[model samples]
Target chain A: SQTIHQWPATLVQPVGSPLSLECTVEGTSNPNLYWYRQAAGRGLQLLFYSVGIGQISSEVPQNLSASRPQDRQFILSSKKLLLSDSGFYLCAWSVLRSEAFFGQGTRLTVV
Target chain B: DQQVKQNSPSLSVQEGRISILNCDYTNSMFDYFLWYKKYPAEGPTFLISISSIKDKNEDGRFTVFLNKSAKHLSLHIVPSQPGDSAVYFCAARRVYGGSQGNLIFGKGTKLSVKP
Candidate 1:
């Protein structure tokens, strides 16, 4: 069975600090990876998605960026955090035109 | 513009009753629809899905119905239990577009099934 792992279940950081959230999938190769954020009282918003290594498509322009370093390893990063950057971040993986599997999300609080 | 919309922000139901959650999409190109359940502080879990070719799909206690003409879909949970209390999100995907695997989610409806 395939499973996704995301680190730092909860994070508290100061403004202008750097951010790094990692996500990895096991039991699958060359799967599509995505990053989504849910702001307070809002739905899941797609931030970025990657079909392969070093290929990323961003949906919304903001303070965050995503990278796919390996076939199953994805990272979401930010050079400087903003107060508006706080939200629930989720990592998901899926095969071509299939339903996605999600990892435990990270709750980021930028103060 | 929001491609997917869940009009209801919350719902209350009694145990053993059926829970029906509705969703609508504005994009005609979306060929796949899905439903997900989520608890606070956790990621959404895939519950059921229906393709445009099929109007309905069932899995255990969950059933998803799609109306392509109306660009709408619904999820029905039979014999709703207390454990069914959570937020339900509706998602749609365009298979032929460049964002094939990318899902567009609607604002979730919080369901509360009381015993």
Candidate 2:
């Protein structure tokens, strides 16, 4: 069974502060990883995706960036958080099967 | 330009009745369509999907139908239960890309099942 793990289930960050969210997958290798954001009671918006290590494709331009350090480890980061950055962030993984599996998600609030 | 659209913002249905959620897209190049169920404060889960080659696909009590000509798709949940009440998102994907099959999601519809 494949599973995804994300840290800091909830967080409160002051404006202009740095941000770092980590995601790791187990029981699978070389799987594609993605980062998505959802506003309150809305759908997901793709931010970035990676097909392999050190390779990332961004969908929407934002204050955030993503990296794939290892085969199953993905990280979303920002140098300084903005008020608009507050939202629900989700990480996912998929492969040839094409079914995306999501993480528990991190609820971030910028004050 | 919203490529994917779930026109309904919310829906209510009696428990044990059928719940039909509709979705429409603007692009015909989209070859794969999917439905995802999301709960509050959690990530979205993969519910079901249908390829362009097939009009329908069924899994358990959930069925997905795709109409390429009309650029529409739907998800039907039979005997809707309280557990089925959540935000459903319609997603589409293409087979060719570094992001192959990486879904482009719709705005979503909230389904409420009343007992």
Candidate 3:
């Protein structure tokens, strides 16, 4: 079975601070990875996705960025956090255009 | 513009009754549709899916129906239970020309099934 893991279940950070959220998948290789953010009472917005290592595609222009360092490791980062950057961050993986599997999200609050 | 839309923000249902959730989309190129369930503070889970080629798909107590002509889809849960209370999201994927090549989601509908 394939499983995704994301860290820092909840965090409180000051404005202009750096951010780093890591995600990894086990039991699968070369799967598609995606990063999404959901504001309170809003739909999820796709931030980034990677089909392979060292490749990343961004959807909405934002203060965040994503990177896939290894086949199954993806990282979402930001040099400086904004108040608007606070939200629920989810990591997902899919294979061959199939359904996606998600990890327990990271709740980030920028104060 | 929002490609996928779930107009209903919330729903209430009685236990043992059927729960039907509706979704509509504006894009004609979307070939795949899916429904996901989410609990508070947790990630959304894949519940069911239906391809454009098929009008319906069933899994256990869940069934997904797609109407390509109207660009509408629906999820039905039979014998709704209290555990079914949660936020439900509708998502769509176009086989081609999707930005970031990812699934697009709609604002979820919170379903509360009371016993």
Quick one: best lDDT, which candidate? 1
Give the per-residue lDDT of model 2 (tens digit) for B1-115.
7889999999999999999999999977788888999999999988998888999999999999888889999999998999999999999988655436678899999999999
In order, the B-chain TM-scores come to 0.96, 0.95, 0.95
Superposed by TM-score, candidate 2 places the C-alpha of residue B31 at a distance from the truth, in angstroms, of 1.2
lDDT (Cα, tens digit) per residue for candidate 3, span B2-35: 9999999999999999999999999998998999
The CA lDDT at B1 in model 1 is 98
Per-residue lDDT of A11-101 in model 1, one digit per residue for the tens? 9999999999999999999999999999977899999999999999999999999999899999999999999999999999999889999
- Candidate 1 stretches with Cα past 4 Å from truth are B97-99
Candidate 3: lDDT of A46? 86
**What DockQ was computed for model 3?**
0.69
How would you encode candidate 3's per-residue C-alpha lDDT over A2-66 as one tens digit per residue?
A: 99999989999999999999999999989999999999878888899999999999888999999
Worst 10 residues of 2 chain A by lDDT: A37-46
Overall local distance difference test of candidate 3: 0.93
Estimate TM-scores for all models: 0.98, 0.96, 0.96
Per-prediction DockQ scores? 0.81, 0.72, 0.69
Candidate 2 recovers a fraction of native contacts equal to: 0.74
Off by over 4 Å in 2: B97-99
Cα-based lDDT for every prediction: 0.95, 0.92, 0.93
